[model samples]
Structures are given as C-alpha cells and as structure tokens.
Target: MGNTDIFLDKYKQLENCAINEFKLPPDGSAVAKLEKRSEFKDIKYELNYCREVRNLLQHNQKLDDEFPVEPSNKMIELLDTVIDRIKNPVRCIDVAILDRNLIWRSYEDRVLPTIKLMNEKNISHIPILKDRRVVGDFSDNCVFPFLLGDDNCHIDENTRFKDLKQYLDLEAHPSEVFKFIPADSKLSYAEKLYEEARNRHERIGLVFLTANGRSDERILGILTAWLIIGQ
Candidate 1:
C-alpha cells in the first residue's frame, strides 16, 4: 500500500501490542495509557506526536483522495522500536554486571588484598560468598565498626572476611542495604525498587540477581544505584 496505509498499519500494531502487553481495556486510549507508564518515558514525545498524526489522518478530511500527512521512515522505525520494547522488555540481568565479571570474595578470602583492590578500583561494595552463594556483602561501612569498637582491633595482611562475619551480615549495616531480584525481572521493577528505597530514605547498595530473587539462590548478576539510575 501507500505510505499512509503502511503507517496506519504499523500504528495499529503498536496499539494492539501496548494493549496486550499492559493488559489495558481494548476500547481505551492505548497511546494515552502508554504515556503513563515509566517504561515509555523515553518515547513519550514521539508517542504523542504519533497520536496526533493518527488523529489527523483519521479525523481530518482528505483532498484529492490523498491524506495530508504521511509517516516518514524514522516514524515507522520508532514505532517498531516501541512495539518491540513493549513485547520484550529489558530485564535486570540484561544490564547488570554479570557474576563472571564481578569482583567478589569468599568468607575465607583475605580481607587486606580485597580492601586494597577496592581502593584501587574505587569499588564500594563486594559480595561475600560461600559455595557460590551470597552470604553477605563487604563495604566501607562494614569496616567502620571494627575501627571504632577497639583501638587494638585492626585490619592486617592475614585478616579474612570470616573475622568480620558479624559486620558483613546483610542487616548488620543499615546505612546501605542489599536486595535480591529475580534474574528475569524487568528493569522497570528494579527502578521502582530503587525509587521506593529513596522514598523511604534508605540506600540500596547492591541488587543481586538470582534465579528466584532469594539470597539462597545462585547470584547471576549485580545491579548498583549508579548502573540503574545512570541508564
């Protein structure tokens, strides 16, 4: 068909995809519903423009048996992108730092070397695992208690993470908390978690992606505030 026909076809596909993806009422305004979702924030303006174009093509009278406006290639591409995004949303693991590339330590691992590495790499948190499962996390906050507890207690070459077991526990440090999300969780869900944490005046240091969002599950990847918010 012509450009107008092609554009209308694609736009209708987009509307159907949005309706099915979001479970919206079939008779409702699909574009308007999509605008309200945080996942569609990036393309809100484009959606609005496309909606206006659709209105013009459907409501305005045509002259000489031709529509006044036709969608460009770029518009068609944008519609394709939005439809694809709605069909297959970006998952948390898709953007997380995968486990193989993560800098982590075991409970029996030396703490001094890890601390030096953290300093060199500017790493704020490191998962403390045992048998490939996260037992706790180590961070600057985990070391503060030791420093302030007793003048004699200090970190040394032979110090192991096991020595700071109490401090490394998930609930031991309240300043920064760790959360576990399923590996297949959508990025929007992760964002919502961070937003809720912010609303509660809490800080989420790391979001570990696991099979079923449980600490007992194997860690597949990790998410940080900078990684999620910066995106």
Candidate 2:
C-alpha cells in the first residue's frame, strides 16, 4: 500500500525475471541462484546487497525505527534501474539488427547494388567480403574520384565488384578502420574497443561483427558510430 510495499513488489518481479527470464538456476534459494549465475559475475556484490535488503524486508517485522521504512523515490528508482539492466543485458547482436547499413557483397558481385545500397540506406562505409570474411571497406568517398575523372575505361552499374578493385584502393590501414568482435559481446565491450582505437587516434571507420569475433569468423553484421551512439 506504501512505498515499501511497492519496493517489495519490485523485488518479487526481479526474482521472477531471474528465474523465468534470465533462466538462473532453480537448484537453490533465490539468493543462491543469484550468486550462482555467471551472468552476475560482474556485479555479485551489488546483487548481494540487494539480497540482504530484500532479506531484511522479508524477515524483519520491524518498527519503522530500525531503518527508513519509506525509501526515497530516487533510491527506489536507482535500485530498480540496476535490477532492470541485470535482467536485460544488451548484446552486440542486439545492436546489429538496428543497423540497416548492413550491405554485404562479394568482390565478384556487381558494384551497382553497392551504390544503390549507399544511396537508399544513406550509408557510405561498407564491408566487401570474400568467402565469408571482410576483405576491405568500400565507400563513395573512396570510389568517387575514379567515377569523376575521365578514365579511359567505362564501367557502368552493371560493373561487378571486381571492376571497382581497379579504381578503389582496397588497402586497409592496419591501425585504423576496424576490428572484430562476436555477436554475443556486450555493447559496452564494443564501445570500449572503439574508445581504445579513438584514444590511439586511429581512423576507426568501421567495426566488423563476426560469429566468433575473430578474423576467420564468418561476418554476421557491421557496426558504425551512429548505430552504437544511437543506442
């Protein structure tokens, strides 16, 4: 009926989330399950604190004298937020689906589709994959000079991916413009990589999402500044 009641209700909801939603082990008590779940490894102490407080709420039929029976709205809000995040951890694949910029094409495929993808999607940076791996990045900025200049040879939209190889510099700067991470990575992990690259003052034009977060892993998705920033 009061703030404390509301707080207790929220804690129940959180426990339900742990069991049904996150699928924490049902072998022991809720506290045991919270501690056992590897997903809470990063915040075990915080979880312990919540368990302690929730325990007091459950066992202590206290007079309002022992503790603040009425927790401040801000306190409840903050704790709820932590529980919510624990319930719903964001993975890189979750961010991947948000990007309409994913335009994967093989080097042997036609270049026209790449151009159309750029215009329609309003995207410039792209990964050119060969045999399910990213070979290089492609963009109008890199390919435009050839189109603008009066090159002796004429290539049209029908020109396949190989044709652009002649004009576009496919050489990737090793220090700049990408790194790979698995789809299961947390968004924060990806942001950390981006930050590290920026701190090194590298170009960091794109981040290639792969199945296992390795050079040999199959490309699953791509990440750009906007997609990460927007989230």
Candidate 3:
C-alpha cells in the first residue's frame, strides 16, 4: 500500500506533464531526463494496468467490470525488481484516504436541502448524525424513490421528515455504513470485505478510520476500490 501512494503521485504528476507539456520521443534523451525526474519505474504496475485497459478498449475487446489481478502481488514484484537501482524503498509505500468533509444532519430536517447538497457534491452517500452519533446514511438509493414518488412523497420544504427515519437507522444495515479502522487490520479481512461486496455487485466505500475508537471515529477518510488498486 505504501508504494501505491508514490505510484499515484507519480502517475498524477506524469499525467499533468503529459497534458500540459509537449510529448518527447519515447526513447529520446529528453525522455530519459523526464523519466529521471519523475521516477516512472515506481509506478510501473499502474502504467501497465492502464496500458492493458487501453489496449483492450482500443481493440474492441470486452473487458469485464471485475478485476482479476492481485494488487498486493503486483506491487511487491514491481518493488523487488527495482530495489537496488531505486533510491526509495518500496515497502515504505502507504495508503492515504481522501477526505469527505461530512455534513451531519438531523432526521427532522427537510430532505430537499439535504438532497440538494448530495446532488451538488456528486456523492452517492451522506451520513446522518443525531446527537453526535451516526444514525444512518442518505444516499441515492435512499433519496431517489422518495423523490420519484415511487416510495412516498415525504419531501416538501415545509414537511418534517422524521417519519422516514427508519431508513437511516444504524441497526437497520450495519454493513452499509463503513467504519474506518486501523490499517494494521489483516489484509485477508480487508480483502474478504472487498470481495464480498464485489461478488454481490455493490458499490464499495470503506473508511480507514484512524486508530483508537475515540472522537476521531466520528469521521476519518474515504477509501474506494480504484484508490486501493493505486489507480
């Protein structure tokens, strides 16, 4: 996971370079200089993965949504191959999650304004808090039916919508709300959770909550499958 961060940083930097600067010949001296500065070898797996996807797409090959390759293996092999020649240690690569400045809302508040925020952020999910504790989540699945009147028309500016609080109850669906925990958690456990979600074909969002179940547990940072694969 450590190399994943370095890989992503290098990938993004190279992406910016490619977009903003003119391309040099793949084997030219200037290309060597560019490679030296950015250290593309640290992110070879990601590049190869992208190349594979591009090849598949360009050739009209059908690629499944599923990921068949193993992430931990690819990262390890890449690091081992370049260990002596590289300046950095591959084992030092770390996983840092993206932050979602969560907006806490009471179930009593009108749904329109809350749903509006969800739409504006382009996030499929939002956490609902009651008395400082997470009570439930407000997501596309939860909001859509109500908006379309297929479930119930409980969304007006003046309507007090606590009646639908059952949808957000924590006990209702514990797995739907991902609790961020320590990275030290066994890779097998993490992989199991990810695999179960993938097999079931659900959108996976797991938060790597910082250590200790303290005040920080209220919110940490978000993790997605693509982010884990160092994409």
How big is the positional error of residue 220 in model 2, measured in Å on the Cα after superposition? 1.6
TM-score of 1: 0.93
What lDDT is reached at residue 131 by model 3? Answer: 55
Q: List the pairs of residues colliding in candidate 2.
A: none
Error of 2 at 8 (Å): 11
Q: What is the lDDT of candidate 3?
A: 0.49
Least lDDT summed over 10 consecutive residues: which range in candidate 2?
Answer: 167-176
What local distance difference test score does each model get? 0.89, 0.68, 0.49
Better of 1 and 3 by TM-score: 1
lDDT of 1 by residue, 1-231 (tens): 887888888889988998887788887499888977888888899989988998899888898999999889888888889989988999999999999999999989999999889999999999998877999999988899867778787899999999899999999985988899899999999999998999999999899999999999889999998888666
Window of ten residues with lowest summed lDDT in model 1: 145-154
Ranking the candidates on TM-score from highest down gives: 1, 2, 3
Candidate 1 vs candidate 2, TM-score winner? 1
Q: How many clashes does each candidate structure show, in the order listed? A: 0, 0, 6
